[model samples]
Target chain A: MSVLTLEDVNSYYGNSHILFDLDLEVEQNEVVALLGRNGAGKTTTLRTITGTVPRREGRIEFRGEDIADDSVDKISNRGVKLVPEERRIFPTLTVTENMQVARDMSSGNPRDIQEMYDVFPVLDELRENRGRNLSGGEQQMLSVARALIQDPDLLLLDEPTEGLAPVIVDDLYDVLSEVVAEDVTVVITEQNVDFALELSERAYIIEKGANAWGGTVDELNEREDLLDEYLSVGGAEAD
Target chain B: MVSLGLVFDQLITGLTIGARLFLIAVGLSLIFGVLDVLNFAHGVLYMIGAYAALWAIGAVSIPFIGLLGIGFWPGLVVAILAAGLVGVLIEAGFIRRVYDREPLDQLLLTFAFVLMLTDVVKTTFGSGSNVVDPPGLLAGSLTLTSSLSLPNYRAFVILMSIVVLAAIFVVLQTTNVGRLVRATSSDRDMAALLGVNVPRLYTVVFFVGAALAGLGGALAVPTQSITPALGNQVIINAFVIAVIGGLGSFAGAFVGAYLVGISIAVGSLIVAGAGQLIPFIAMIVVLLLKPEGLFGGAEA
Candidate 1:
């Protein structure tokens, strides 16, 4: 059975409609990349899944149970966690405190705090630092580690590599690679096509709030026409 | 020449007043820090607390604890419970509706509550002022020197405020609920996504904040008169203190309260009729120098 399935989902922000009849499915322990251009409703889809959108309709099933009308915290407690695009770390809280929050609130059996530090050794070094004091790379690591400590069944990463340097992106890729190896189900949304393709097995392309195309990573790599039509990779191709 | 003993006496008096102000202002600061709502009804909660304490003292009598006679201790407990209950209702029933509204709308709503609650107090307790005497155990003064003496009640207020401040610090720094509060105050949406029940937390915070105001009012019963307009008068000073300390900073409130208290005490001695103007002047100076207040960085 699929870990998460969204069928004909419709979402709105106030009167402005953002998603229309969006259908998606993720198998257990599968790595899926949601690819889209800016404002193509990629983030909105993640927001809808987490119940953060102001209003949403249609079926969102996790572990075969419908969660369409559940509150954000309820959905999260059921083991669906989103690492938001902005990496909303509590600036006043220390690194350990940030992880402790997720652990305290986690409904599932949480990973021990020491284990999180072991996975992200850099965080162990900066354990005493406040969230605002960390570098971009460190904050991203902490954001992911914080979610991972909750031991979420399905992890959602929204633009995790949005504002990092090449070296930092490489570091995050390694961390996420280890997380995936632990048999954790993952879904990622990214503008970095190379990074997304490298980390995901299958991919879905969304355009104008609707699914544009979906196939295996190899199939997507061969389809240059679809890439040009849906993505801004035309500029990268010229370079 | 102004004697050193006189200055010492004024300092102690200033601390007592600051202690009272801290009880009221810290609640205002906490509510704003977490809910991002300026509760104009906060003062009314304080007023309710004072009235509840007065009523409790008059109505309840226990011989065993009569050492602090006239139900002073019982009144304090009743005052806290009454104020906290009312605060919970205000947040769950009324303030929750305006969470997504504009600041002006929130202000108007709370201001409406202030008017209504004040009237309710007027009808229930009568418009005339009332007073509660200090418990017999705290009815005397402690002579420190030839010209220096501290009223036992004032000393009690000061000691109690210190204990409350310590408790607040420990809870905010060490407890799970405190960590959640800090997390929520910084980013509401993020906290929600992490499984923190934001709405329920708001109610809990409102209760704590309201209880603090009640505690402040109950403590004030021995020092000041209670009236329907008392909340309106104290709330203005509380706002000034919160602003001076920075709107969401607990440490700032602590320091700011004492600063205002000292200014009032010392200013009265140095310049006649100038004590009233000193706090405002200090506020202007602080605002001009640091618009975010003395310790404004992150919420809570």
Candidate 2:
């Protein structure tokens, strides 16, 4: 069953048009990767689904219910949550307090705080520390953990591995791998094509604000020409 | 050299003055901290609070309230409610329209409320200055020593400030709503995306902020001559406090209020008219030293 579907969605940031005729779908409990270079509306697509964009046209369906016009919070209440690119942690709030915000805001039954701590044990150690005091890797973990606490049916991750040391990235991969085992569906937008493909079963390539190509992970890996053309991911030989 | 007794007297006076300023300035700081709207009409809300208290005192004759031994207590409640209601209307009706617009638009919108509300107050309460007598229970002075005594009402005001400060701290520190407020203040978009109702939260904040201003005005009723221009006059001091403490830093506002209060009181002792100039001078010095304010970080 499809958990989320966007048909012919065109989004705008004030006067500048971002997403153009973007069509996408995510099946229930599936990890889908949205791949593109910078400024290709990958983040904007996630934002539009979450109703963060200023203006968006076309249909956005969550669980077969049209939610194209729902407000951002309302969309979130309906079980779609977005972990934005910048990590956007509340600097003044303690790590536990940050998680408490998500728990308090969730209309659905939120995950247990201890469960989140179990997944990201570093968060437990720094639970009393303010978000600003955390390292970059810690902030990202907190951001992702905060979304998970909401117990969202469909989670949107924007550039989850944007900037981090290789060690931190490996840790995040382990955490996400654990999350994928749960009952939630994920739609992730990424510039790191290799990392995204490793986690996602299917991939959709977006270029210049529209869908360029999409297929199973095996099919996408076979098309080196498509990766080089759209994602600027050099063919296997170039590496 | 100033005598210790004289210095003590001036410090008490300064604290009383700072207490009143905190009532007004903290609201301005909270509104800015959360809503990101510098409400110029905050003073108008304070004025409304004073006028509301004055009217409530005259209109209601609750014998039980008088029996409770605090005649003007009900008046304070009225002031907070009236000002809070007006704040809700201002936020929901006017300020909401300008949130997505530029900061100048918000400033102009609030300034327009200042003008409009001031005129409304003038028409209703008249342009004449009004004064409220301190409640009978607190009408006398408390004698400490042969050389040291304090006005009972001023002591009450200081106690009230402390109570308000404690209450706010408890609410912000312990409550879920408080956590949401801190989260929203830090990153509004993220808070909203996390399923927090941002617009409703904005309204709640404005109501609290406006209510605090009204409480300040109502509290000042027994202390100062209430005039049509009272809001305009106090708002300047409130702004100075907010700026000195840093725009959204709560601790900054508290320390800044006391500093301004002490400066004004002590400066008056040193020079005849220096009280009026000291706050500005202090602001300039603080800005020169630490541009963001004492407790102001990048987030605040």
Candidate 2 CAPRI-style tier: medium
Number of backbone collisions per candidate? 0, 0
Off by over 4 Å in 1: A234-239, B1-11, B59-70, B270-272
- Report model 1's TM-score to 2 decimal places: 0.94
lDDT of 1 by residue, A1-239 (tens): 89999999999999999998999999999999999899999999999999999999999999999999999999999999999999999998999999999999999899999999998999999988999999988999999999999999999999999989999999899989999888799999999988989989999999999999999989999999988988868565322
* Candidate 1: residue pairs that collide: none
DockQ score of each predicted structure, in the order shown: 0.78, 0.75
The C-alpha stretches of model 2 lying farther than 4 A from their native spots are A235-239, B1-11, B59-71, B298-300
What is the clash tally of candidate 1? 0
lDDT of 2 at B257: 83
Q: Name the candidate that leads on TM-score.
A: 1
User: CA RMSD for every model?
Assistant: 3.2, 3.4
lDDT per residue (tens digit) for residues B1-300 in model 1: 889888887888788778888888889888998899999999999999888888788832223432223488888998999999999999999999999999999999999989999998887667888776898879989998778888899999989888888888889889998899989988999999999999999999999999999998989898888898988988887888987999878888888888888888888889987876899998999899998898887456
